[model samples]
Target: MAGEGFRSALEQADDRIVAGRAMDGDVAAFAVLVRRYTPMMRAYTQRMLNASADVDDIVQETFVTAWQRFSELDDPGKVKSWLMRIVSRKAVDRIRALRPVLDVDDIEQEAPAHSAPARVVEARAGIEALGAALQELPAAQRECWVLREMGGYSYEEIAEELEISVSTARGLLARARKFMIVRMEAWR
Candidate 1:
C-alpha cells in the first residue's frame, strides 16, 4: 500500500514536470529538481575523476547543461538518469583533456630494476600490469566497470550514464571484471 502511494506521488510529480510548469520558468521547481539529483552527480563525477579540484567544475557544468536543455528533455521521469549521463560524459572529457603527456626519458627511468627489493618490485609490476590491462579495455567497458566497482553506482545508474540498457551495462561490467581477474591472475 505504501509502495503504491509512493509510486502515485512520483507519477504526479513527473506529470507536473512534463507539463512544462517546472521548465517553463519556475525557479522553485527547478531547485527541487537540482536538490533531488545533484548529490548523485557529484558522487559519480568524483569516482570517475582522479582530481578532486575538477569535480565541482564538472558537476556545475552538468547541471547547467541540464537546465539549458530541460525543454528538450523527452521524459521528465528520466531526469535523474539524464543528469547522470551528462555528468559521466563531462567527467570522461575532462579526464581525456587532462591526460598527461609523458616524456620517453621519464618512462625509461621508471622501468623496474633487478636490484630493487622483491616486494617493492612485485608491487610496481602489479601496478604496471593493472595499468596495461585497463588501457586494453574498450572505453565504455572500462568506464562501466570503474563506475560500478569504484564509484559504487547501481546497474540502473550506470546504464543511464553510459546511455546503454541495464542488461548491456551488466554484460559489459561482467566481461570487464572477468578480463581483469584473468589478467591479474596471469600476472601473479
Candidate 2:
C-alpha cells in the first residue's frame, strides 16, 4: 500500500536525489541505494580480492564507510563510482594484509560457467601470463597498475594513496600498461 508507493518513489529517484536524501540522514533512501548496489559491489570485491578474503565483510565495510562519509560526496551523481572507490580501497587494504601469499588461481573463479573447456584452459594460461608479467614489474609500477587498472582509481587518487606526485603516478601507470601490453601480446 503506502509502503509500496514510498518504495517505488525511492527507486524512481535519480542518484543525486537519493544520495542527497541519504546524506540528509534518510535511512530508507540509503537502504534503497544499498539494495540497488550491493550485488554489483559484492561482485566487484570478489574480483578485486583473493578467495580467502571475506568479500561480504568488505562489501559491508564499504557501505558503512559510505554512510559515514556520505557528506563528503562532492558529486552525488557519481555515487556509484564513489561506492566502488570505497570497495577498491577496502579490497586493497585486505590485499595488502594477505599479500606475499596471494593465490592468483582464484582468477579462474571469475570465468563464465558455460565456457568451453578450451576457453577455461586458455583463460588459465592468460592469468598465469598476466601474473608473471605483473611479477616482472617494479613494485611501484605494479602498485600503480593495480590501483589504476583494477581499482578504477584516478591518477590523483592513486598518487595520493601511494604518497607520490601525480606525475609519478602517471609515469608508473603508463610504464606498467606498456609493459603489460608487450608481455600479454601472445594472448591477443
Candidate 3:
C-alpha cells in the first residue's frame, strides 16, 4: 500500500517534492529520491576515489546518511547537490582510511610490471606527483579543485556543493592550482 500510489506519483514529482515527502518519513518517497540520485552519486564518488576506494560503499553510505538525515536538508530543491556533498565527504573519509602510512625516503615507485613504455612511466610519475601535491592542499581547497577540474563543476556549482561563497571557492581553487603547478614543475 505504501508504494502503490506513492511510487507512481513520486516518479513524476520534482526532487524537492520528493525530498519533502521523504523528510516526512515516507519510505517510498525516500526510495524515489535514492533511485533518482544514485547514478550521479556513484559517478561523483568514482571521480573522488580510486579503484581501491570502494565507490559502491561510499555511495551506499551516502544514501544511508541521506535517509537518516533528510530532515536536516535546509533546501529541498538542492537535494542533488546535497547528495553530492555527502558523497564527497564519504569519499574523502574513505581515502583517509585507505591511505597507507609510508616513510618518505623508503617510498620507491616500482616500474609497471608489464614492461610499459616510457610514456607510461612519465604519465605515472605525473599522476603520482599530482596526487602528492593534492595531499598538501588544505581539505577545502582540494575539494574545490577536484569539483571544478575533475568533476567538471562550475564555480557556482562547486560553491553550492561545498557550501561556500563563490569568491571563497574561487580562492580555494586558485590556491590549489598554484600549489599543484609549482609542485608538478618541480617533478618535471
Candidate 4:
C-alpha cells in the first residue's frame, strides 16, 4: 500500500506537471522543488566547501539560477543532476573568486579547531588536517576527491559533473588518494 502511494505520487508528479506549473508562474511548484532538494544540495555543498556561513547563500543562489533556467532544461528526469551541476559550478566559482585574495599560509593557519570527545576530537583533527592538505592540491584533484569521498558520487557521475572523461576522473582520484595517504601518514 505504501509503495502504491509512492508510485502514485511519482506518476502524478511527472516533470510535465511541475514544469507546466512553473511556466504558468506558480512559484509554489518551484518552492516544492527547493524543499525536495535543498537538503541534498546542502550536504553536497558542505562537503565541497569549507564550512562557512556563506553556504546557505550559495545554495539559495543555485536554486534561484535553476529556477530562472528551468525552462531550458531538456529532460525533467535529469533535474537532480542539473541542480547538482549548478551547485558544483557555484562551488568552483566561489573557490576561484577567493583564490586571488586568499593567502595560502593564512588558510593553513586558519583551519578549524576540532571540538569533540577525546576520540572524536582526534578523528576530527585528523580529518581537518586532511582537508587542509587537500586545499593544497590542484582544484581538479581536490574536486574529484571530495565528490568521490564526501559527496559519494561515482567516477562516471563525477566525470559527467566535472565535464571530464571517466579515465581522467579515475586518474585524478588515484592521485588524490596517494597524496592524502602521504599527508595522513605524516600527520600520524
Give candidates' CA RMSD values in order.
22.9, 22.1, 22.1, 22.8
Highest-TM-score candidate:
2
Clashes of each: 0, 0, 0, 0
lDDT of the candidates, in the order given: 0.80, 0.91, 0.87, 0.82
Residues 1-188, model 3: lDDT tens digits:
97577668888999889888888998888888888888888887788775555888888999899988987899988998899889898898888887898898897987765556876787788788888888999999999989998999999999999999999999999999988888778675
Model 2 agreement with the true structure over 1-188: per-residue lDDT tens digits: 99999889999999999998899999999998999899999988888874545899999999999999998899888999999999999999998887677578755565566497888888999989999999999999999999998899999999899999999999999999999999999899
Off by over 4 Å in 3: 1-5, 103-188
Q: Flag clash pairs in model 4.
A: none
Ranking by lDDT: 2, 3, 4, 1
Model 1 quality (TM-score):
0.45
CA displacement after TM-score superposition, residue 54 of candidate 1 (Å): 1.4
TM-scores for every candidate against the unseen true structure: 0.45, 0.52, 0.51, 0.45
- Please provide, for model 1 over 45-127, each residue's C-alpha lDDT reduced to its tens digit, 9 standing for 90 to 100: 88898657899999888878877888887877677777788889999999888898888767646435655688688888888
Scored by lDDT, model 3 comes in at 0.87
